[model samples]
Target: MTRITAVWTARDDLAAMLAALNVDGDQCRYVGGAVRDALLGIEAADIDIATRLHPEEVMARLETAGLRTVPTGLAHGTVTAVLPNGPVEITTLRRDVATDGRHAEVAFTDDWREDAARRDFTINALFADPATLEVTDYFGGLADLDARLVRFIGDAGARILEDHLRILRYFRFHARFGGAADADALAACTTHADRLKALSRERIARELLLLLGSADPLAAAQLMADCGIWRVILPETAPDGLAQLEILLAREGQTGALPEALLRLAALLPTDPLLADTVAARLRLSKTQRLALGRYATPWPTSGTARQIAAEVQPADSVAPWLLLRAPDAMVSEGLKSLEGWQAPQFPLGGRDILALGVHAGPAVAKVLGEIRQRWIAEDFPEADRVRQIASEVAQSAG
Candidate 1:
């Protein structure tokens, strides 16, 4: 008899919604991720409800109780009851009638076991009574959860065949929850890796990014590559840079900064600007993300002094990728720390300043300004007076 008592379950809004739906002893319970996360002592991000009542009845009861209801997924027997805390998706128990690997045709059911059997994994199929904190495990989800194993509810291949996206979801879940891949599950994922092409690029990108964003995605990423799953989705990339990722994660932890998903993704890529362009196009990353990745992929100078290169690269975003690529290098680490308060020195001479120096307003003035700026940067940006004197000399020579 496993029980979960968590803030999500004890919320008054949730209790009220459950009470409204459970009028006359109608069964409704918290299901899926909420139950699993609560039992694991992680704060549940969303609360989903499975009910014996049909979708219409669930909607009618909630509406009559003065709670807002949205027919968010009515065709799939789901309705959302919006509460102050967050939206609670109330869905009638369902069994799959047909599945074409991408979409499913489901039939509503009253039997909880039927619904549990159709779920992707055993650990995600557990249900908990909102009122009594009692959990119903038709399958051995509790045992699997205790062992930190993510196994399919029944046949691994059959479950994956129902929705190929579950293949990535399998790895994503393992990354967050800390589990080794079930043998059968890994085999099924590898066999059906090609089916991932049928999924929309947006869908594939979303799942892959989520996997990459997990607490420790390196192991799952390596497994995906070894099994050809990585090739199916992102053949141009490799997991060879995972060691750099570990270092970047450690640095982020030390600084108390939120982990940047794009940075982690960049760590997995080769330092080739062309590959970054291809990946950005393939993943349809946002404009900002693409720019960051493009800068990250730019090759750092291997020959220059650290300070010289650091002065050349001013934007923190530009320097961050190089530092991450060369993480734990004492020189690179020191350069990164030095950049904390450093601002790029402004060029002392502009086109107007050149003009004031008797240099005619033309390409020669621009050329002389450029040369003086180069000297300034090379000299590590000397005092403004010295730079101005140097600029004046260059401008006079050009004139």
Candidate 2:
């Protein structure tokens, strides 16, 4: 009697949508990650519905029931019902008509098991009766869930051939929930490791980032390297990168740093700025993300105090994660402590101030300002009076 009725019934939309869909028959069930997460006592973030109704019929009925529906992926048989909280995606049951590793041409079906069979992992295929909260598992998903194993739905090799992205998804789920990597699934991913080349870099990056964001990606990550999957797909990162990530993860917990994915990603790479840019471009990261990762790729400042370091980078506390990644624990503690309730004190003397000191409009103004700047930073960004004094002395010295 595995039930999530009390949990999901609290959401306003689920009950209404279930009522609408079950009007003629029991046509819809909560499916995929929502069901798996609910059963695991994790709050389901994304609610997906599986239905025997065709795509058009589902949309029609939802609208007729006064639920607004969006044809999110009509070809893939998905409609999104808007809720006050968030969107719930309702998808018609589908079977693969054809697939080429990267893409699947699917056809709507009335069979729930057929839909379940077409999914990637057993734990992902579990469906729950929204009314009774009874879980229907045609593929032993409940057993696998209880065992904490992330096994593929059918033959691992065959399932991967249907969608190559499943190779990455397999490791991701394994990292998140598996007791141990399923041997066949791991082997299949290794065998089809080359097929990962066929996937767009964007797809590969998305999965890798998600995997890196997992509770303990290092387990699955080390496995990938051992299986030669890493060398095949991402040669930019060597096996040693995992060692760095291990340290970074510990530092994150130690320093109270949020385990952010991109920041973790920066920690996962060698401290090579050029390589970070290459990887960022390869993944087609946004301009801001590319810059952030690239900036964090350099080694942390070794010579300065935390305030000085923070003053140098200025504006953003971008150095915190990298400091955690590279520096010793003592330095990390001091650096993080220095940053808390810290604002980047505005460096008081601009070139204009130097110019106003009659250092001239040319390179001498720049030169005196450079000296003042060094002293200002070395002095931990002093007040404007101190800066003006430094500027006056530097200008006088320059003359």
TM-score of each: 0.87, 0.96
Give Cα distance to truth, residue 250, candidate 1, Å. 6.1
Which 10-residue window of candidate 1 scores lowest in summed lDDT?
324-333
Give the winner by TM-score. Answer: 2
lDDT per residue for candidate 1 within 256-292, as digits (tens), equals 5456677777777787878988898888887777777
Cα lDDT for residue 164, candidate 1: 88
Q: Pick the lDDT winner.
A: 2
Cα error, residue 365 of model 1, in Å, equals: 4.9
Model 2 Cα lDDT, one tens digit per residue, 271-343: 8989999989999888878877887788876698877777767326567766777776779888888878888
